[model samples]
Target: MPSRTLSAMDDHDPLTKAISPPPDETAAEKEARVKSELEAKRVSDAIDDDIDKQRIAEKRGPKPVRVLLLGQSESGKSTTLKNFQLMQDAKAFRKERSSWRALIQLNLVRSIHIILDAIARDYYPSSRPLMKDPNSSSTSPSVSPPSHAMPLPKETYLDPELLELRLRLDPLWKVQEQLARRLMIHESQWKEGLHGGREVVVNSAVAWKDVFTKKMANKRESSDSGRINWDDPTDPGRVLHECAEDMKRLWKHPLVQNLLEKQNLRLEEMAGFFLDEIDEITSEYYIPTNDHILKARLKTLGVSEHRVELNAGGGLGRDWRIYDVGGHRSLVTTWVPYFDNVDAIIFLAPISAFDQVLEEAPKVNRLEDSVMLWSSIVSNKLLERTDIILFLNKCDIMKTKLSSGIRLKDYVVSYGNRPNDFDSAASYLKKKFAGIMKEDSPLPRTFYCHLTTVTDTLSTQKVITSIKDMLMRDNLKHSTLLL
Candidate 1:
């Protein structure tokens, strides 16, 4: 007990003895130990989460592959889509139905409805024009339905005024939505989706083809029944009277007038929304930094069409944001930006158009001139290296004409002077592209041209597969080890 130094206490061992932990610890000590263990466990858990996130990022693989289809109006851009992307065969459609790609497309279709309806309003006046007379004949030409045939109308063609209205009002959204819904129905009803509890139903196996045929038959029957013999003018005034009433109602529709005021705005909104949805789909499915392939319609949006990533896909399948631009000359200007990042450009021209093109050759010179003219416009601006695929669309028609030696021009006045020979048409194309071909040995990796059609399913498959194979080759540079 004399002044004990710490060292001296060590020697005595009293301090150690007093503080020594017992074999059986107290509850307080146990609680502290448990707390320390829990803290360490939490740190470990956080590290695990971080590692998991990293693994997920790496596992998603590279960016998606994109394919762009660009061509003139009536170049069979839509037909190419029918042949390539659309699930034509039972197997492909079934496979795609369960895929995120199908979902993305469905979403695109759904968005179109909203956009088009907004546009339709613009064609009709916010308020109906005053009638010539309260008691005027209902048959007045102005009393016709809006651009589209009113659902209840018994006429085959919409009234001329209404048709003009549709032309004035952009109902592209509506038309697009209607088509999309039809496709959706085809998928759900003809393919897969739950009917009850079990997933045993094989929609493709059902007789959906017959259902369509029956519908056509019914339509024909109705058409025959509703036939109006214009030769007989016994009821001329009757048709006129009904139209006047419709015009009165249409003019009075507040909804129709409201739409007219907003039509231009609606189109702007549609284009914006379509682009946004495309981006959303792409961001969701496609990997970052990679481009997507587009086979877009050129009729409504034209070439200045924007693309957006719709979603991501697993290995082997890549997600895309695609726009089918209008094929008409008016919208071709818009196709420029789309060509920049485009990996491949499909020049769609109807096989049937070959003769007509040849007939006009004296004016345009070479088939290559026509193609080169288009190619030059888009190719000159491309930042990303690109390849081209020339689609001889409507090959079914071409093949039929080719095989039968029938001049399609006989039936189609637009074909110009009927060509006596197919060789002239073929020779015309070869000569036109000859200069460009000579400039690029064998074929330029920068471009590829093919004569194809979506209606001819086999040819379409070959064309798309070949284009995708080329794209995969490009991707191979970024993914050589994986391959």
Candidate 2:
């Protein structure tokens, strides 16, 4: 008991005795103890592995906030989708640029068809009775709606040189027909979110059969050419050259202008299919520019979802999905599936449509339809909490349409003739839309809006950036996945 070591003293401690190793025993007993210790370690490691897996699963698959592009047909929703591609998925946009060549050609051909239709309508009237104006109270079958009728342009005719030129370029029309039929087939076969048919056409489609084919060259340089030249000097260049003079003449002719005026058609927005640039647009190796693609209108058939992993600013590596749907009334029924988890909705209202009629419903004024549609969306219980961003799109077109004497008061009675300018008309539309938004939403929903010509990428990009910033702030405010 003179100087006891610490171990010797601890040997007598109750706690030490409780945790002490077992006394030396038989070999079988030692082996059994070893087995039990190994088994415990194995069980502990398995628990750790399960915990690591749970953490990895949580970090791996973060849900993407859905954003929907919503509007009536021709309201610029798809164009906005293309802009997102251009901004977020530029490589993809460039990859698809060649494919868009066929679409641009189709748009030009569509203009030609529109002119032809106008000419036919003027000379050869339809047997089916024309629809009466919904605003009018007249019951007489013979009563005409001259007020709504598009203004007639100066007279034009198929003269000698024009007729000869038209005959020369007749094959182009056939190619146009082929493109149209392909689009019809593709669209008819499409359902919601499945664009396999679109890709099918993209794979097999040519700009214009017999007129041109893909000429091997640096794609960037090929896309910028403003001449009737191809890297591969094929036959189409000669065709465009032969009719270049006549093409210019055809575009400027009062007759064509008359047709455009009569039909209230603006082919310029569709790649601005200028007759002066016939040589360029109809080139054998034509590649559509971004602006051209912006102007390119492909009638949407179903919902197209584009997933963009934003570079920075917006939680890097985070998924920003932009959706574009066929804004037509019939296709709207497909929009319900998307409503379940939407974080935002970019609603496009073509302010220019104030005096126009819905393509689906001929008698319904476009603005009225837009208001009703807006009311339905903003008031929808399903979407009450979703961020609703209004884009009064086509401000450019609205300006031109207003300048052309398309009166807002004529279509929207509430407009009341308080200056038929862009500001007044746009303000009127904004008020109409704002009235529909739910003021009492529990989420403190804020209304974000912009007057946009989405085709103008410069301005639209600014708006997009603002939206991106706002979204980041909102996420931080609510502590939603903001890195």
Candidate 3:
């Protein structure tokens, strides 16, 4: 056979025949078909052109200042992010007040549960082991039952009044479960060992705020007044309000306090502690204020990214991206992928945790874990050039612990015979972190250190302002170098 050309073969193709015009097609049909095809081609070309323009605009636009926040659990990473949002977008922050109310109420419920559990444990010693002495050198400060399991006796002696309070507050436990599920925490996540007892842990990807907001919106739509109906029997707030006085009595009982002291279970030191504000937090009309929202604790499973547009300081009218990653030991490896492109890293070390231990790794001291995490971040080759800021966080808590006669030498043996005051201890820990960055870093970078109680709005805002100025100046310098 003679050589067959590609075009000649295409003419006989099935697709070509199917799309071909009818053999008896009119002249008007061809004219109309040509116009339709031209119109479609013009529309497609316009879309392509618009896409190219958008890509070029994105390339030429100012690059956002990206900062990665690294820390172990409860190191104030989320608090710091909230501070940024508060300062940059106060309106948006306040808009979510109702949503935060649910979390604060949940926190209060959890604290109440802890107190009741303590009372039960004290009454029925055979039911569970005593809480570990956090100050002990041999054991972790995290409150967990002993490794040995013990069977409960047939009967135990609990105060009649306390028993009544516990019984009346039984409904709060169901409210806790409801709020957790509403926040997108599945029963499986809890059963699979993703969270500890009554601790709320949800993935960052879940729009938890919307869960509350959408519900409120529907309720508001049904009501004549555009306000949440507090009278709804299903609202968790009602249960909390009804049990308010009993909860207050339970929290303030002298015997309860004595038992807590004996067991070294400082509920105030833990995250989501709201026992002190039961009267205000459990009110039917309760709404979370800025401070309440800052102190409220909700453990997140994955990384959360927040964007803020800055209009003040060196980088005026600049957009910034802050990445808040989960700080649990199991989640640490997930942070590596975000390290490569970040402009700076804010590593929080909760120095106040000198006497406490990691919940995930009970044997390891929390402060020591923070040090190890800091070392890993600074020494990573990928993060060598990125600016690293050290926040020796929880200074306020450390001060209280020191004032209460908790000796630094007892836990940090290296501090032998030094003054056990807050200033001396904070300075010592800051130096320790500085030394690690200096010695272990892959490259020499400036060490920026701040002693912070991130929940303190005025102080934290001042620190945030300084950080913004420093990062913007450095970013400008880098841009100049690129030129």
Candidate 4:
């Protein structure tokens, strides 16, 4: 047997040297030391008791509904989360308004929406209107039409600087939109370096990052130790100059010049100078994601897309923590740390993307690959006991899949990590996850799954109702705290 390394036990604390071996046993000193030890133990015991009480209370407490949302990038996860937060805040406000506890509390719900709208307006250059009409029955004015019932409405805090930016960009967006439309035209008959042909391309609003965000840059200076500065520019002028130069070169072409004149923005050197100023003004408003706190909040909203926690003990409570990672291949690595603490796992697959799913399956010795590679990654990492829900998301858009009944397995031409049918495709996911967990650990003991989407009320309601029943009813046996 090998001796244990000293580093293994290096975690132990060194003994305190405060006490002198009671000088020749002075009774008074000995008694005082004993009393101090007793007090210290009692204090320690009280803390431990409180913690235990909290844990027990939590176990008996209403099982906060824990949900994990995962999906590919641009899947509208952040939007979903923001909407849900708004709804939740609204309901909470309505509840508090009934009681005259605090004036601030009473306005909590309405304030949540206002703050959210303000934040949105600040971040997005062109904000969708916050309210369609106070009396209108429309759910959300800015969200893409056919809004789904989100858990709550959008609400996130931003730093003062970002808030100021969002305010400044409000009117600029309108100007830019108009410019984009007008610039779709051409220039004059003949000018400086006029060429005879070639057309101009008008692009919509500029990318927010390129125009706005500034990054810190290091430069060599005369001082031995260089100075740090926050005024580092993002090269906005350079970009405008380049674009203007390109536009001028294009205007030199006779075809572009004619089009510009029709558009009314004549091909003049003075116009190019004006464009430079427009770019400068446009560069002032940046997306808030660069700030760590704001970025984290945005990330939180994104995660909440499919996952949420409802704390019965609302204020500053140590409720459940949930993680719902995006399902993109690039985002898969983030899921690893979350996996260890997960009591349950939910995997979302678009039923309409069945062909894509078949091509990306991870099993070996099967034909056809799966386009959604994260499905296999999750399957291979899930614990056997961990409750698993294979949500065939976006079923509203995939009703045809259920009717077609075309098993994915039938499409498998050979054996090279291929799933044979739709049923097999799902099974492959479950089994692959189970096999991986069994090989690694022994904790997860349960697995169940279903299909769902947040696109429609009926469908979303069904999914929510199902989840409520599962996490609150069936699992309530183990969690007496769930309401």
Candidate 5:
């Protein structure tokens, strides 16, 4: 009994000493101190009460459907997210349309700049290499140039008119840099001689849309007519409009086309391609269409979370949260935290990238990387219960490449003797991915696969609807099981 009393006394000593009033306190001082302590305790107790209420509410509420979009860079993850927003929250998606103008403009300018860079390379055949080979080593045998970097034809010659156009369009590079810097892109992210000299990358945490939105707001505030000052000298749109003719000529010139062909530079097949729509895009008051926004190539650097309420179909009123993570090799490590408690993962493997290598890891085949990533994902115990949906994305591009006689067997050597047609190629690759899932998964799970061209709004929306139905059904099943 004495030991129990001493233990209780010891437990209270420090707290009591800390809270006790001074020994020499007056009557009024003691009252004030007591009131102050009471007020603090009241606040602390209220906070605890609110926290407990919140916990209870969370336990009673319907959990939001959580999905993770996983893929390498340029695999259409962002486009898929845009489609979701478009379908579920059309009003909100349209509200951000104006803000996408600057990004689309940047995309157009970057494409123009790439063509210019290709022209420059042809002109300066003996000039120093534009990019260092990431895979090259001093002791190893010489590596061949990447498939995209085909050797310039010996007889290639630039038209003098093309040179004049290049000179006129030189100022647009500054505009590209300006727009890129405004979006928080840094020097390190800018890869010169890579994909037409430089690529624009922004962290998902950066509210890049808000940057342009605020700029437009400020423009409105400054304008007398309450409209954007199109004549603003700093506006990239103005410069793009001014050089629109030259951009068209440069893109259309016969020699320029020949040069691009020799180098295997198919800008149309590339993301953020706008050269074909030069006139409409460079108009004085151009607005991006839904297709343009989806096609715009702004590489995401980190993880981005998007939340929307499902307003239609079986999932009405249910909240959905979609996470888009950076798919670059270096950024893949950041995807681990999001794997926990995720309801589904949409893994995009661009079958069209069979002929290409990763921009970050120059030697790694992109398709192979996708397969490896899939294997790692399925094998992880953390994602054992997570529904894995495989999107053989860029089916359109794959079709085009196959039609152009770019043999899949040439790249995927194990695909030997298979029909080089789109269906055959897509099926083979899909089966290969399915095989990996079956063999490597920690636990058996249903394999959901889709051949998706996420850019096509109608088809993608249909696919998304089906996916929503599936997820909603599964969610209800789990909730019922818990009951």
Candidate 6:
């Protein structure tokens, strides 16, 4: 066996002199080196922890394709949201249906307020009235009465039932005034341009916390005889039910009907439309169905978000975040932030609104506003890749309007008295959108068009299903983790 080689001696040899053994570490130096190593390890571990946190956050958070619902006021955006909930979270929607009772109460009260204003207008003779009415009650007051309002204060014609309804629902009328006052106060708090600022002018007013409480109590009264406890959680529906018979009488009275006619008023044309269905809606344990919820019309303010878990085959799929922004011209400015990161935009254009003008600025036609708004959207560079769907909403209303002799030519002017039927008018409206899209859209977006009554479920469901499927196909190709 060969002898094992030993360390070379380096005291005198040149080759050995070139190499040296490591010097023995001093205690202080060793401590310093160890301290430096420990700090380096701590930094490394801290960096790893940060990376892990970021990874976990990315994993745990919802990976939803955000969709923004864009449209002008009364274009059925809220109704579309309800349809989505019905398809995805039926139980949740059912739960929310009961809450509409208070809103309908507020609505009934609002109609009374309008009638009161009309009465007050005809009650006295002057350009100025007893009170400067805060706002008109019509959801769409574009059409004036025959330009000849009938004479008023036919007190002999007013029914006792009318008087009773006007009295029983007085508390709710007071509630509306209180709500309107609260809304105006919060209205100033609204921030401009989509910073997630909210307007409490509509549905939110119903949700105001402790909203009905009196600010300064009256101690002098012996009893709260005139008071109505609307805050009593269980009895809102009961109150309307109790007054149902009287409500029907009030609505059916000849003089009352004449007044509505004279004012060209149709309560069904506005929101909170329960006057006709008091018995059915106010029955005990009443729960609204998907259609009832969607059919609900309120001049809703602010943005609402609904989250849904998509289904792929039989399993829960990706999360979907849908946003519905306020559609009024004043509220339109609040729609931009929602555009960020949005993958799809469902735009509702009331094609029949060609005859109607803006409630805010009566000079601008509603359909014209829709066209200009559509043009701005399609042409916007911020939404270059966002898929666009146009819903020509209120086909039911459009058809009714056409048959009632509201000529499209009278409003459109360019129509030149074309065929005055549903198909012709609808086709013309479709062409208007198509023409605008062709001329204004800078992107090669595939336009999905549908004629929707918004209240009709079967047809709207078909369109909703088609869009849902397409969205799944397009969005899932990129999200391969999805089943």
TM-score of each: 0.38, 0.68, 0.79, 0.34, 0.79, 0.67
| lDDT score of residue 27 within candidate 4 | 88
Candidate 1 local lDDT, 1-483, one digit each (tens): 699467644554777777566669889998887798799999999999999985685478644345566665446564555444443232223212212232233334333323233333333324221112243244421111222322323334434554454343333323323332322332222111111000111232333223433443343322222222233332222222323333334433465446545532222111112333344333322311101112222123333222232221211344443445653343455555645665455666554644333222334422234565554543453423445556655545555556666664454344466464555555444444544544543333444556654645555666666666665566323223222
Q: Which candidate leads in TM-score?
A: 3
Predictions in order: lDDT = 0.40, 0.61, 0.75, 0.36, 0.75, 0.60
RMSD of 3: 10.7
Off by over 4 Å in 5: 1-59, 126-157, 181-189, 221-233, 313-315, 475-483
49: Cα error in model 4, Å: 23
Report the C-alpha lDDT of model 3 over 1-483, residue by residue, as the tens digit.
Answer: 999666754647878789888888899999999899899999999999999985786588877778888899999999999888877766555556667777888778777766766666676654532233244333221222221122234576667777677677777766776566445455434311112235666788877876666666666622222244566667788888888998899889888899889867788888788999998988878767788999999888788888887675422466678998884765775576566878778888999899888888879999999999988888888877788889999999999999999999999999888899999998888888989999999987788999999999889988988887776566434432121
Which regions in candidate 3 have their CA more than 4 angstroms from the true location?
A: 1-57, 125-155, 191-196, 221-227, 313-316, 475-483
Please write out the lDDT profile of model 5 over residues 367-448, one tens digit for every residue. 9999988888888888887888989999998999999899999999999999989999988998899999999998888889
Candidate order, lDDT descending: 5, 3, 2, 6, 1, 4
lDDT of 6 by residue, 1-483 (tens): 999555566346656655533268688887887898799999999999999985786588756757788888778887887666656654544333324444445455445445544443444334222221244344421112210122335553434555555565445433544433422333333222111111224453344322322211132211222223334454555555565666566667777777767755655655345567766765655555555666665565677676766565312466667888874765765465456567678889887677666666778988999888888888777776667888999888788888988788888888877899999987887888888777777766666788897777667767877776776567423232333
Clashing pairs in 5: 193-197
| Model 6 misplaced regions, further than 4 Å | 1-62, 125-234, 297-302, 313-316, 472-483
Which runs of model 4 end up more than 4 angstroms from their true locations?
1-65, 74-322, 355-384, 400-447, 474-481
Order the candidates by TM-score, highest first — what do you get?
3, 5, 2, 6, 1, 4
C-alpha RMSD between model 2 and the true structure: 20.4
TM-score of 5: 0.79
lDDT of 2 at 472: 71
Residue-level error in angstroms, candidate 2, position 456: 0.5
TM-score of predicted structure 2? 0.68
